[model samples]
Target: YTEDEGFVYLNSIMDLYSRKIIAWTLSKTLEVEEVLKCLETAKRRRKTVNPVVIQSDRGVHYTSQKYKELTKGMIRSYSRKGNPWDNACIESYHAVIKREWLNRFRIKNYYQAYQLVFEYLEGFYNTVRIHSHCEYLSPDSYEKKYILEQTN
Candidate 1:
């Protein structure tokens, strides 16, 4: 989500437990719809039955009334101003994604960036890449293990 000619805004939601990118969207504008889509996608993908708390930066979209309504059932939290530590998990993930993957490619347009991001998230990052925080398991694997453990 750079301001370059070919880049677009990337709104993403991460799960701290598995260090996974649960949901995301790439758009030409930083409209509230972008983050809302990400939030809804995360809930659906996770099959979230209970209220979940979300921690975000003090961005305009996060503070908007529409967003508050959309997340009405859930507890919304904000990171402290000028404190990256308050949102360290997601901030670190963003840095990792840029350094380990996105920086290697030369994106030609927003469409290409979107496709590339989708592939990286779905095909590689979620399924293949192991994370140290998740006991050296990939995010999907970590979640699967939890399910298996519960069923056993």
Candidate 2:
């Protein structure tokens, strides 16, 4: 969904296992550069060559030269011609944000919105949102639980 303040392109990398957002970026336009920036943020945070399969809609930005360069030989790419369910996880995250955050609040400017997004994501969503995939645990909690379960 596009925001009226601007284009407000939101890019997110989702963990398929727990259906959690590991990384995300918000920008005023849906440029290939902005998309690459989101991917870079995810890579920096994860700091590993994990075999991540990034699925996105058939948007030009997703298929652009810069985006392909970023994912080249690093991450697998998947897309559907016109199906949203093909990338359900991140799509769902977008819906959640709109319903829970964007719809409920108004921002004076992009900077304020940016900060609010950061707080909503890092402060609340990651650690607090109950997810069915993790039996009501948040993403961080679910990851910790998985680690413990694996180490045992």
Candidate 3:
């Protein structure tokens, strides 16, 4: 939450295969609509005919009818109640981003927070930062290698 914005929520979708953040939306509300927007963005960015399993915490937004409707063709998995470890990857991502980047800034408003998030996600995390889960390559590089291997 930003100082002036009251409560800013970040809804993100991660592709577990490469640990890439496929899409994200920073919104002022925690409404299911925001989550829907994030999902839509992910769908637009990553075009795939194969169905994928989407895992999330049992948040009200994820459990909503609208969310279910939009994700009709995909499998949905929810974390056991009170067990955050069930969705550890995304939980860790939220922790890492705050500890390494967001914690360092005095975000006064929503726009500032949005800018910081964009820089960390697009400029660094996806393109430059190495992850052991990705075999020490950045998410983008790791994904490229995987695609290249599939074609070859």
Candidate 4:
């Protein structure tokens, strides 16, 4: 995300099943710490009983020692080389975020970009925007429906 000040990187983790953004962190730089922070936030937010297999592109930030150490007990999966489709969901999401939301605003700084993205994820994307794969339900609705089916 490029603001008037500079480029800001937005790191996010989405729940694969529902296409819901479980956690995110925005920073001015692509430091390994930002990646770790996003993962940690996801872990704390989800607290899923099922084992987690984090699928990420083989970016330097993901390959860093800090990330490896932080994910000590979690499963880490990487997209296959030369096959970006393996992670198409998240990849497509990046485009949608930029196209459908961020591009609409002339973000002045990191704060402005961050606030807009935060609103998009919480107010619109997860709650209002529908996905065809989810039977045209928003991600939050999809997750709730899935949970209901499981419990019943």
Candidate 5:
């Protein structure tokens, strides 16, 4: 979220395991409702989801009253101040997203960027992109393998 092009807000929830962008929402403003909607989207998609420990920077959106009220008891929140390493996992994902997808393209508008981001996350990153942590398997494949191993 930046003021580069008339108020852009990018909110995303990422899994640390395979660096998967589980859910995200891009909006024209940093409204609490928009943030809530993104969280709801993540919740709906996950079956047998674990209660998460969400770590983020001390951004206004993450520290807002609405977020605290909405997500109370559902997830434990942690914030980092002036240290990028505190949220290293998601920071790494962000770096990759920007370097590989967002930075390469000329996004004429917010909607176009939104669509491109969504497609990259679902179609490429989660499904096909190999990660070092998973020994070169994509997030989805790594998750499946982990579940299989756990059940066995």
Candidate 6:
């Protein structure tokens, strides 16, 4: 939430294998279009030829026709209603970001929120912050190690 924007929504797509946030969009509205944009961004960023499985909460945006159409070929996994643990990985990320970084600032507006998010995600979380799930390597470094292992 921001002082000027009231409440903003962050739509993000995380790669489960690497626990990496492949794409994200911060929007003033909770419209499905914003979620779709995030999905499109993920598609462009990953560019995988293999089938993908996307897991998301059973939100209206994820249930929308546009979202289903966009992810036609991909497998969609929805968490059981009221079961947050099913999507705990991403939920934990949201909580961690707020507790670690966003909660430290007095965000005045959407721009400030976006900037803070960008810095935390791009500068620290993906590049520098270590994760036990990634064998104590940062998300980017973990992914690079995986790619290198695959090639050799």
**Highest TM-score: which candidate?**
6
Q: What is candidate 4's TM-score against the reference?
A: 0.93
- TM-scores of the models, in the order given: 0.92, 0.88, 0.97, 0.93, 0.84, 0.98
Residues 1-152, model 5: lDDT tens digits: 33346546678888787677888888887687887788878767764455766666777767788778766657655655676787777777777888898877777777777888888888898999998988899999999999899999
Candidate 2 structure quality by residue, lDDT tens digits, 1-99: 334475476778887787667778888876788778878887777776656667777778777888887877665556656666787777788889878
Task: List where candidate 6 sits over 4 angstroms from the true fold.
Answer: none
Better of 2 and 4 by lDDT: 4
TM-score result, candidate 6: 0.98
**Residue 94, candidate 1: alpha-carbon lDDT:** 73
- Candidate 2 structure, TM-score to reference: 0.88
> How displaced is residue 57 in candidate 4, in Å?
1.1
Error of 4 at 60 (Å): 1.3
The C-alpha lDDT values of all candidates are 0.86, 0.78, 0.92, 0.89, 0.78, 0.92
Per-residue lDDT, model 5, residue 88, is 79
**lDDT, candidate 1, at 150:** 96
Q: Summarize candidate 1's per-residue lDDT along 1-152 as a digit string, tens digits.
A: 44356448888898888888999998898899899988889888877777788999999999999899878888999988898787988878777778888888877778778888888888988898999998999999999999899999
* Candidate 6, 77-150: lDDT as tens digits: 99998888879989999999999999998899999999999999999988999999999999999999999999
Arrange candidates, best TM-score first: 6, 3, 4, 1, 2, 5
Report model 5's TM-score to 2 decimal places: 0.84
Which structure is stronger by lDDT: 1 or 2?
Answer: 1
RMSD of 5: 2.6
Per-candidate total of colliding backbone pairs: 0, 0, 0, 0, 0, 0
